[model samples]
Target: MARSIKNPKKAKRKNKGSKKGDGSSSSNSVPSLPVKVWQPGVDKIEEGEELQCDPSAYNSLHAFHIGWPCLSFDVVRDSLGLIRTDFPHTVYCVAGTQAEKASWNSIGIFKISNISGKRRDLVPPKATDNESDMDSDSSDSDEDGEVQNGGSAAPVFQLRKVLHEGCVNRIRAMPQNPHISASWADTGHVQVWDFSSHLNALAESETEVSRGASTVSNQTPLVKFSGHKDEGYAIDWSPLVSGRLVSGDCKNSIHLWEPTSGTTWIIDTNPFLGHAASVEDLQWSPTEVDVFASCSVDGNIAVWDIRLGKAPAASIKAHNADVNVLSWNGLASCMLASGSDDGTFSIRDLRLLKDGDSVVAHFEYHKHPITSIEWSPHEASTLAVSSSDNQLTVWDLSLERDEEEEAEFKAKTREQVNAPSDLPPQLLFVHQGQKDLKELHWHSQIPGMLMSTAADGFNILMPSNIETALPSNDA
Candidate 1:
């Protein structure tokens, strides 16, 4: 029942007539690129005739919850629950959640699948205990080559503490440290969980510290850098250097720390002075490790190159309102996307700058603030964005030119305002709930598949294509 306006001719006419000098009006006539549309065919059934389901649909339906606030997420190579490269199917996620009023949590891990294709059949892999069992059995053997194990081997692993009630605001994983690292708002601490260890002892130790414990000797934090005067809103580990991490706080300060060496570095050298309000999100570039990006409550996106000390590599006065989230496409580091409180999404090209980085493409698609944005790992041009307007938008940037060129093209197209519409039609709208959407994530292994979560506790998995077969009506 929902329809998008298709007014290419009008848009072109509007653009062509606009003054060439005004940058704002230049982007108004840019047309969206063409996308594949799934049409209902004769094979589609009308009533209860029992249609054969596509095997690919089953494979695309597997959705897993990675974390809570999930303010941010990422995927890595050869991760747990992920298949090998030869399989060509794996997805990793990093998400933030809160645990009651106690602490913030972040979870990062990888997922794998045996099948392939956009619509392939997916069967949950059977449980196997080949290597894990072998290691357990071998641990029980003494150094003398004699089996000293008797009663259940004393259960070598134990759960230290259970985090029952909290949510994670955002999470990130360092390629430098395969272990997961996340920032929690409730406890005001950056927690790192090691996957190799059976038990997470550091989290337990922090729990004790909050309870007035004097000594934290038994538990060790790889490094605890302290400069946040208040709750830290966002944190990211450096992909280029091991143990180097950066965090933004409520006080509007970004601090860089070395967790292993206990050394702290401050890069506040720019007159930019960072954000005017609290910082909400930050991300490091996938292609160049030294370059990073940050978004704040003041509706601005700034790219910082640590080598330059405090000033941003480029700053763009992006949104009209608060900028909530930002992400860099893994395939094209030059391209980045951001979501804002203005119910709009903006895509920028890092290379397009006569003065500073400028907006290349923009979409005013939502009725409320955009909550999250994520780039597909497989395709740099494809992006998934979620908004408080209760909808998720999947954008194809590959078909569109960067903003500068788009602006020039639109200026020329406006001359044909009275012509027929040439703009592409809307592909699809995920219209399950009327409630605001909180998060959206794409399957790492499968292209054109994504998962969305809402404040109402509803999580839905949607495929790019949905087809149903019907009985032949010709008879």
Candidate 2:
């Protein structure tokens, strides 16, 4: 059930830390005491404030959840950090670092709170006896002996935190820990924070931690690569290998770093540059760690073999406009999708043979710049896309048929005359008829369900079965 609460005075008080001129102060007299100042931005806004605004208005004003209103400026740089959401109050992670100089400085978890909403009070109803009985069959052994499976485990919802005080261009979650790695567009060097220890300390101290403290004193950074004259736009941790990470910058260069040794490898060492313009996004193949793909502002997509260290192994002139995002299907290693500023999205099959390595599936639907694309982890062929046109679309890549095969199938279709629909019916889920979709993510635990956030500050969790082909209004 969804509910909204209104409290204007409380909303204002919640935002007091964000008010201009609020600053953090420390005293030598109390070295252990930490002073926290609420920096004004969107992430700090109470959920009640977000729920009160018109969804459409929220979308237009806060597109990308970027800039002053969205408060998404803070970047999380270390292994442990905290993000607050509307429900369950707070969420945190423990992060691992690759820095070698500070091997003893492990990442610490941190927490921040001032969340307000009825959703925070929501708890799943107590389980019935039959449900408990069913859960007993799936018991797992733990330190506390057998544990029931069907009972509610810890809540899993998390909101992204503004890790730094500047604009965040790239964010990557560490594979080993709950920690996240981020690079700021404004700051030149990378920083890491331990969110787990911070959260634990915050729980004990019952206070929020300061952002710019000497928190990473004991952390480890594998390597710190320098030489990019422009802002770094993307950073990705190799899922297949620990301590190996890659980053791309606005100058159209890709840098590979070994976090522990601080060794740097400039992959683009030749004139056959991967992209003509800045590399907007890059993702390592979930299946093949040695392989990865990069999309650029030049409207091109290049697939690279990390070992070659020079030119891309395969290249495709993907979109008419700059490609902003790339997402790999978790279930299929060779399947991927790209979103572009031209308001179109293309799906590619890495396994398909091309004249010179081309995209397999090309989809153009959004009329405005497509900002984000996400592939469902649970469903192999399902994909979710969001754009600046204030729209979110769920695409089924399995429905795509090759042109030649489609033609042959059409000839047979004429003979049959009454063929069943080849396109599986789709469930177009909408939230209050508003569509300024900025980001959408499928539940890691739940199949056929996902959540979406809009620039308008409206976040919704909707199940795919919400709109089935039923005669009645409710499915």
Error of 1 at 135 (Å): 44
Give me candidate 2's TM-score against the actual structure.
0.56
The number of the candidate with the highest TM-score is 1
TM-scores of all models? 0.58, 0.56
Off by over 4 Å in 2: 1-165, 199-226, 261-272, 356-358, 399-437, 446-460, 464-475
**Local error of candidate 2 at 55, Å?**
14
**Per-model C-alpha RMSD:** 17.6, 16.4
Candidate lDDT scores, in order, read 0.47, 0.46
Tens digits of per-residue lDDT for model 1, 170-259: 555566555545444434555554443412233222121211112212334343434456565567777667756677866677776645
User: What's the lDDT for candidate 2?
Assistant: 0.46
Candidate 2 local lDDT, 127-179, one digit each (tens)? 79997665345432222111222342422222223234233344455554434
Instruction: Please give the lDDT score at residue 18 for candidate 1.
Output: 8
